[model samples]
Target: MHDASCRAGLARHGIMISLKRRIADRFHTSRLARSSVVVLLVMLLCLATWATDRRSLHLQLLTYAGSLGFIANSVPVVLLFFMVLVVSRRVIFTSLIVSALMGAVYRINAIKLETLQQPIAFSDVYFLRQVNASVIHLLSHYLSARIFLFAVVSLVILGGMYFWERPLLNLKRLSRIVSALLLALVAFGLYRGVSPARKLYDRNVLRIAPWAPAASELHAGLLGTLVYQAIESSTALREPVDNAAITRLARLEVPDAGAPSPVASQKPDIIVIQSESYFDPSTLAGIDDTSRLLPVLARARLAGSVGQMRVPTFGGGTLRTEFETLTSVPLAAFPKIEFPYLQIHDKTMPSLVRVLKTQGYLAYAVHPNDANFWNRERTFQSMGFDAFYSRKDFPADAPEDGWAIADSSFTEKMEQLLDRESRPVFIMGISMEGHGPYLENPVLDKAMRDSIPVPSTWPENAAKEYRNYAYHIHHADHELGRLWDYLERRKRPYILVFYGDHLPGFSKVYTAAGGFDDHQPASTQMVPWVMVSNLGLKMPGQPIYSWMTGGTILCSFAGQGNDYYAMIQKAQRHQAERRMASLDRETLEGIESLSRLYLRGEAMPGNVKESARQSFCAATGVTNP
Candidate 1:
């Protein structure tokens, strides 16, 4: 009887195992299961829109009931998922691909925020088509090694999924064709605002701030803000030129100071060095002595017009400063252009290079980074530069400090160019040595780094970052002094303009150590600039904008300028007197309109008719010079 009871119990256990296997098989093959998986992924993607940015998910949802923002955020992901699903015929595989793509974007956004103090802009998307060795090198400097690991892991997981999971859909050829066509129609409809989602996004019903990307991403959702920006960029780039405003700007009186032209006897070789991420650390709160780090700069400042100079961008976007300095056109004028070089496409734009070239001065640009990084190869030509020497142009054996080419090596190249030049040369040398992710720099040894001081109360990361930044700038300073001395010894009169493109992106340092003594936030913080000449050129040490640099250099060396540059000089004087209140709205709009026209390869300021000029002046209630 005991043997029979044991046999019955064993049979019951076998029956239960068979039932569990059947259930598992059904779950794996069921269409409902695949649908459910897709649904869960969509939900998670929506959550990540705010979660990845470390913002309050509850706050984002509370803005509206069941927030249209969530729906807006899901549209692109859903579209992508559907498209991939159609191609892969496997729901799980499609979801993995979609998630990986989105995850990469989120990671990049996070890095940009940390390093640039700004979120990724629509212009950054252009990098997709611009993949090259130079771009990869730049990514290496800015991005982490973990991204490659993530990619590898993702690929391995995807391979497993592809092999383990069978195709979920088996459609006939006609059905597949129909589905693909339908999806194409839907995508086109959404882009053209036929869908309510597109219309709402275009109107920005959530009022996502265009300028403040971080806050906008948090409030509206990252994907939603990105879609909104895409819509806006599409329309903004197509807007008609404001001919009236351009006319007014072109006709504005430009006061001439009647200063003697330094070129009366001979034209000076003008050298403008735009240092990357350059600033004096002593300007920050709780930091006083930068003499050890920037000894040459300290002494040179005493001899030149050295002061804080306002630039358009904060941490990155070096070309914005470059553009303003070259064109004497404030970036504020082109409000829609984030990366001006990529956005503004013209064959020959008005520039200091053109002005110098007109006077028989040979214009050249040298940057030991990718010439194509900021579309410099194209934009430099458009800006009227006769020649541009980029990364490929530099010596393959050039010395490097950290990941960037050393400033010393860059200075040596400039010296070579100067030595080879027979005519007056306008050399715009942009340095890359001081470019950052300062925490990982190992170029400076312990003893050298120890010499650069930070506040004791600062975090280890902040102190290390500050030390790395100081190390780079110290080398830059040495080169600056070397360049100044080299020019002085040449005995040929020369004008030397040195300035920071923007302050170093030391987000960690700023967070721990605070900002300037005046309590200016990071966005408003100014970088130092100095202009000196062997010809006794002198100007007040007041703050000026990067836009003023070109005009100042032009007027100082030539003592005469075109109408646009003369207007810039006048505005610089006003800026000095009024500080932040310099250019009013009308003036700014006029300047912007003129800048746009100039970028379109139109005539410069003086081409307008006398009658129209007088009318514009009279109507605007401004005196004619």
Candidate 2:
């Protein structure tokens, strides 16, 4: 028993020695190990700096080396982390794992921001919260190879970190605290001392490249760009509207007794359809099967007006156009508003619906999606619709092939509403059947898919997407015919205003099919708008339309005049672009000043301020008001 105990003691001592050696190696204060960790951090940071800009490797390397002084920027934060390492006496693996993970996230986001051509502005974080599959798909095209690239680089970085995990045993608490504080001061002080950062602020570099954020980011390093955006967030520079300018605009227009939403004399039944991402397929090149694209629209094209509708947002943000057409206010004039519904909650506006109500029409809105998307429920009420019909109100069996109500069913709903109405109806329908994620588009069946011919040179993905979009577009066109045919036979005279909200987000497919010019931005492309009227409703001046002009167009059919309608008529007569480049700064200032006054709680009507409803009713010769 004594001999067994002695052997056990010996084994225990041997295990203790081995454990001590392992701990000593991992937690040693070796000068070389400490220096290696510092070097690794420096290298990783330099790499991150280069990744922030999409520049050639040689130029990026030079930039990295040149900005070595900025290494001080991260040192204090890193030291604070290392101090925690000291307190816990954790293995160097702990420090390396944490730092490297942080570095990977930071660098990856920087790359994405650079690719987006926008800095991490204040709204960007907010946008993240709203991200859905569509947003991911939109970003995926730009980052085709980035995921693989990031994984490879991160693997290499972590591999190196794993080998260099070493602790700083002699790093005393006082010494660590002082070093961290001093390093923080040095970083801030040196950053402040630099003239480059100061110059970025002095010049307002961000404003110089308002459309191209990447240019500003390239000029200013990531940190500098961040600072600039932060400052701008807290204090956005708003162009002041001159009060004197408002009076000058008033002088420019003589009160016309006639113009309806800008000039309607007849109270015709009006139907406006805000089609989701619907466009003329023939507008793109190489669409062999466009024979089925817009048959009814082709026949109706010559009746009223047919041209492009220029919208503010692209791929998404449908409400921007909806608000513009409903109210004669240009979104470009309001820089601060993103989603107007969110901005103007519970606030009444001079909308087309409000105008129609005064004309003794039952104004109603129909959207075959959720009531709360983009907060349409509140916005529709504010716009003066009597009530809203959303997804919940749609038929339970509405979805035939996929989610949401089908366009065919939607047309059925419109017919039912009109039939059931006690008065002439002003129906505004926002269609969702054409909304996308074309990847999951219900296959038009194998037989139909086989009918469409794809270009040989086109990428597989583009071809597939176009085929799917074509299927939906076909359905939309067919349903449109049904609506038009039904309207043609109706006893009441009617006007059908049909327009696409915006071009669909098909990415490279748009260019691949030769539909859009690859050299230009997608937002610059226009969607087709056709007004088919049984009541002689027509746009008098410009063939093209903007959101702010929709109300004016509708009012013209009623022979009504309002402040906005009058302004729109002058713009159309003068063939003025929204840019107002033909006008002098003074004239433009006057125009904007008018917009500010009129848009701020001012609903459009007569030369004198009056209720929008009253002005609309009076224009229609109704003595009720």
Q: Against the true structure, whose lDDT is highest?
A: 1
Off by over 4 Å in 1: 1-44, 47-65, 145-147, 181-185, 188-198, 236-256, 577-582, 603-625
User: In order, what lDDT does every prediction score?
Assistant: 0.74, 0.60
- Find the candidate with the highest TM-score and give its number: 1
- Candidate 2 residues 570-621, lDDT tens each? 4443333333323445544555555555567544334323212232211122
Prediction 1 TM-score vs. true: 0.87
Each prediction's TM-score against the native?
Answer: 0.87, 0.70
Extract clashing residue pairs from model 1. none
| Residue 507 local lDDT, model 1 | 62
Output candidate 2 Cα RMSD.
Answer: 7.9
Q: Please write out the lDDT profile of model 1 over residues 260-373, one tens digit for every residue.
A: 334455688999999988888777888898777788778877665576688998888899999999988777755567877877776777788988888888999999988788
